[model samples]
Target: MFYKYETHLHTSEVSLCGHSTGAEMVRAYKRAGYTGIFVTDHFFNGNCTISRKLDWEKQVELLVRGYEKAKAEGKRLGMDVFFGWEYTHNPYGADYLTYNLDKEFLLAYPQLCRLSFKEYSKLVRKNGGLLVHAHPYRTAFYIHYPPNPKVHLVDGVEVNNAGAGSSCNNNHMAWKLARKNPRLIRISGSDIHSTEGAGLAGVAFRYRIKSSRHFVDALRAGDAYLIIDGKITDQEGNPVKEVV
Candidate 1:
């Protein structure tokens, strides 16, 4: 069987929008046949319930609680748990899923919330991290317009968001962008906020990913496929209709 891994998820310990705790989320994924997951709880400016009144360092400390808890549980279950954040770019509701950076990087760079898309791209690249624009084309009633930053600057675009299937998500546009730019990685995820969202989307790696760093490298090298609604397809190449 392929090694499945969830690329995006949140937890009640950190994200205000999340309904389940980190441990609950991990257990749900484990039951769904996933070998690992990235605990991408909301960042400082995202749908975070944490108090921003606290100092930047303190804020990071609070933000990492969910990831740490999830990681610990993943260890106990023999799952590969990794840390990441879903940064909410203010003004526009565009979200970016980041990987390969640890809790310390976030604590060190609290100003991350203030950076423009261009600036954030540079910072992530400098730190050897990958930034995948989550549901880049997703439009919401609250968000006046769809936020599409310079696609070339981002490492990838989430072309399939299972959680967004319930809404009027425009993932087709992201798929077109990926086809036009062969170098741009086309990723997918559940964008899960609750236990029910688990396993709706994930990646199916040809080999078991050893760590978070390896996961990043695999996507960069186009070494995996996307799993959407229980159907699998090679996202590194031409696009196909995701099973609804």
Candidate 2:
């Protein structure tokens, strides 16, 4: 049987762009047949709701509240919830989905938001974290700068982002980039800000992923299947095995 998991999700408690609470998202994903989900709320540079005036420690605590709440609900409902955050690169509005790191890591990096994307990426990889570029070719009004696909810096590239319903995210371009790189990991995400479209896209595995770190390992090893447009497929979006 195949196990499904959502890689990108936001909660109202942490992200200003989010519409649902952590518990609500957890319950929604559970109802949609997701075995697990990674709560990837917006980080400091993004649309996070936490106050920067608070100490770094305090910010870290508040930053994880959404994940903590989702994890608690997931535990109660027999679902796995992992922690992650989306670091937004300013001017360009390029967002990176970071995983495997914990609250302790956030506490240690008080200058997290101050560092450049390349510097922060090195630090994250040094500390055993993974970064995936999300929607690299997305052209939106808020994105003042051009696409900076730091393909070398990121561990993976999200070729498909279902967040923009009708708007074009130029997913085809992302796929081309991944194809050209060959070494870069390929992923898909619903980028669910609300429960209305929670299960439209994600990744699936032949086996259940145990932790956030394990999820990263699976992606790095190319063991996870991409779920695009409600179909399970490989990185190239080919038809794949069924869940039974």
Candidate 3:
């Protein structure tokens, strides 16, 4: 069994995202023959509102609505939709993609509150969600802000990011880390912020992932493939090498 999925797509409604609508994402993913996608928009404590002020509850509400709308559209188009959020950790910042969580959980703990990486990892684990570090090697303003350790505290790392303008050396870094810590999972995604970049990056898992929970479990169990396009394969799965 096999499944093709893109987990880090963005829509225009997101503050920093370009003009890509959820309908456009559905069309693109269907055209690319992808089985599923997770729309993980930016969720920052500082810029949670339209006015760029901290309204954490409103931000979660917006994201929940976005997910519902996208899921409805994807269902109509014969594609699976996964609800997710890209949380921006503050003070020694990092980005984490979390799924299968409720609005209450997000509203309750919108910010990490000076917790160390290890502590934060424990919190995520206790909540039955997965943490994936987003785009660790890009050199833009916010790209290089997150620090990378020889040992990561979370479940996985996103090796490929489509919105990244340069060659992704992050995949190599993630691969080396996964090699060292065999428990770590390496996943790749487009991180698409615009229509043009949607479906441009992804990961193919060898198992038949029927839902969001299955997809997350595949990554947590290290039974997935990372697609960096003409780079290399460090896991098992047939590659669909065309850029979507």
Q: Which candidate has the highest lDDT of all?
A: 2
lDDT of 2 at 108: 86
Give the distance in Å from residue 164's predicted Cα in candidate 3 to where it truly belongs: 3.1
Off by over 4 Å in 1: 166-169, 236-244
The top-ranked prediction according to TM-score is 2
Q: Would you give me the overall lDDT of model 3? A: 0.66
Worst 10 contiguous positions by lDDT, candidate 3:
45-54
Segments in model 2 whose C-alpha atoms lie over 4 Å from true places: 165-169
Q: Distance (Å) between predicted and true CA of 154, model 2?
A: 0.8
* Candidate 1 residue lDDT tens string, 1-244: 5788999899999999899999988899899889998999988888898998899988888888998898889888888888899887777877889889987788788788889878988998799889888887776764554454568778888888886672244777777777787777877789888999678788888789988889988988888889877667777434344333
TM-score of model 3 relative to the true fold?
A: 0.81
What would the TM-scores of all predictions be? 0.92, 0.96, 0.81
Superposed Cα deviation of residue 161, candidate 3 (Å): 2.3
